[model samples]
Target: MEIGNLNDYFKFFVALVAVVNPVGAIPVFINLTANQGIKARNATASIAALSVGIILMVVLFTGEAILRFFGISVGSFRVGGGILILLMAIAMLNAKMSNIRQTKEEELDSTERDSVAVVPLATPLLAGPGAISAVILHAQRHDSTLHYLYLSLAVVALTAITGLLLFLAPLISQWLGKTGINIVTRLMGLVMAAMGVEFIAHGLKQLFPILGAS
Candidate 1:
């Protein structure tokens, strides 16, 4: 089941959106940059988005080799990553941020730091574990360089959309308010949960071919 078809590529994009949930991260971006000037905030947004794109692209291309170095199969990693993403989705569904993405310590640390565009905002916050895992798992579905290129493009598109959202964070925050943001988060959470389950199911089937036969 190579990611040669448009549907598969679209699913990859959707999964990235569901897990990334840029809309859900708007409030965080706003709060993190609240003390900064408009220009500074915009700069932060641009840096964060660019950082996310770079991180995901690197992971997508090098992830399999990293797993091989650790002697971990894609199927095993999928199950582990699926559980992590599922936990995140549950937190999102409850309209709360997951500690898995950023712990209380990290949040506090960000507040004390002068620059947070790359650390909390970009790394663990935007391009965190679930996002990286999603890229790796999706990359495993490819059999050719063309498919890898398509996946890389998808990553670019995801970051582009996220960057745009962060750039409009203030306006989006004013428009959505807390309640609207929470509603959107919950909806995205539902989608994330579904994707998490799909990852786990596929991983299980791969690890145990008998399950696929059944």
Candidate 2:
């Protein structure tokens, strides 16, 4: 509603984008769909995008309740999630996929599948723990109904953009080339690293108000 709120939401959106880093996943999408025709690749992209959005939205809404069941404190979860995100950020900085999301074996296995829309693409790549945790942390921190609605919209917007990128994977690949993609990935990596540090700092502040005040 206000400019500050809009800016906050924009940061939230950026955190989602950075953690998911769809641009970084483009090469993987291309490799996975290399065997398919253009139509099939587009189909896979659509499904993966929709699935990822739905999964993350569910987590965003229900994450706190799930944590309660598991007896995990928000601050504790924030610290852990920050670590996970930081690890992925480091991996991205190196221009490689994070092993936390997928292993080399999993990537190899995707090649043997008929469709990878839900496998490595949607789960490990898009809606992996890092992304899910980030959304959950954001949701938990901002629990207003208005924020919840905005979060859902943000997820949809992100997924749509990611799908568009995947749909144009070929053209994007040709345009960006390997070096360009790596450059973009590294930039996003820097953003992710900053977000990760912020998450950890917030969590620590919550746990230690004295340090936060200082």
Candidate 3:
């Protein structure tokens, strides 16, 4: 078996980390499962992570094909997707949920449901448009089977990390406190903004090859 490339894996992790921002989701996770017992909370965390991992894995492998079916070019996708990620980053920095990722409707809906792991937690919160775009972009950049496997591994690893954090949500909240979480959120936002800019730059280079020559 081919060894996984650290550099590629790092890139995947960075992009995924910035987009997923599992740390940023702690408050919401805590709120969503506030009434649940420890076992229920742990189960919720696992399901959310598993669901998100599945969503990302599917997109990572099939996003290119989906774009092709829609006749969307990588350059176009990068520019558009970058914009989405940038907006999310801005919201993250502001310590608010982006409407694009999670809306008031979803929040309200979550309160009514006994199980929110698959809906708001996994679907939009963890694997929403921002995360989806980042994964597709990652797939576009690293296409080899080995690299793809690495990408898949990164998704699993990140999701597992996310789950662990959620499982320990109460402790994390207590240790980090609200102020600490906000600080970390902003820092992650900065990293995400950087990723967005890189995406736009790369896409522009493709859309206008002349720029690369100059």
Candidate 4:
């Protein structure tokens, strides 16, 4: 909590950023909102960003309660989340995981017009199961309320920044070019995969007493 000890908070911020990878998500955002008008696209981005912030806050505050309600331990959630992240990393590495086509199908419905941000963007794309699980695990790790608040704020700020960058994704995509984007995506996938392995290892260590003892 002291000024000198803020390093931990900063470290947490970096970890959250790496896990969320807002910059890495920009291309997907561009692809998803390609069909919408400028105004609609901007609105969707704003809503999606706000939705992600809200979802993170919920996980930070009530994540334990939610997990308890479901009779799921934090270790269990991490193991599951680790697997999900691994799958996502594979998709990122392969570059064929965009849900734009599926989103387009859903958008074809009249009632789906207002749900764009909440549906594909906010849910699976931005604050999907992997993100939710990550935040919940983070909350469980941080016992201090102040640290939790700081970490949550950092996550929200990072998410908002990512969303803002995503709103200008056309320019970013042009600047990055296909090759640059592919390189960045591959790098992010590698990092994500490593994180997934760490999560799995942590969960297994917790679940297996012998592993923890050794």
Best by lDDT: 1
lDDT by residue (37-137, candidate 3, tens digit) is 99999999999999999999999989999999999999999999989989988998898788998889878988999889999899899899999999998
- Model 4 residue 203 CA deviation (Å) reads 0.8
Candidate 2 segments whose C-alpha is farther than 4 A from its true place = 1-4
Give a tens-digit lDDT track for model 1, residues 98-207.
Answer: 99999999889889889999999998988999999999998888768889989988999998999999999999999999999999999989988998998999999989
Candidate 2 — worst ten consecutive residues by lDDT sum?
Answer: 1-10
lDDT string for model 4 (105-192, tens) is: 5535523454567666676666777677777776777677676767777777777786787688788888988777777777777777
Candidates sorted on lDDT, descending: 1, 3, 2, 4
Each prediction's whole-model lDDT (CA):
0.92, 0.88, 0.89, 0.72
In model 4, residue pairs whose N, Cα or C atoms come closer than 3 Å (at least 3 residues apart or on different chains), thus clashing, are none
Question: TM-score of model 2 relative to the true fold?
Answer: 0.96
Compare candidates 3 and 4 on lDDT and give the better one. Answer: 3
Residues 1-214, candidate 2: write the lDDT tens digits.
3122877778989889988888888999998898898889899999999999989988987899999999998888888989899999999899988899899888789899998999889998889999999899888866677888888889999999989998988899999999999999998889889988988989888888898789
State the displacement of the C-alpha of residue 62, model 1, in Å, after optimal TM-score superposition. Answer: 0.2
Q: Any residue pairs clashing in model 2, and if so which?
A: none
- Count backbone overlaps in model 1: 0
Better of 1 and 3 by TM-score: 1
lDDT of 4: 0.72
**Runs with alpha carbons beyond 4 Å of true place in candidate 4:** 1-12, 98-115
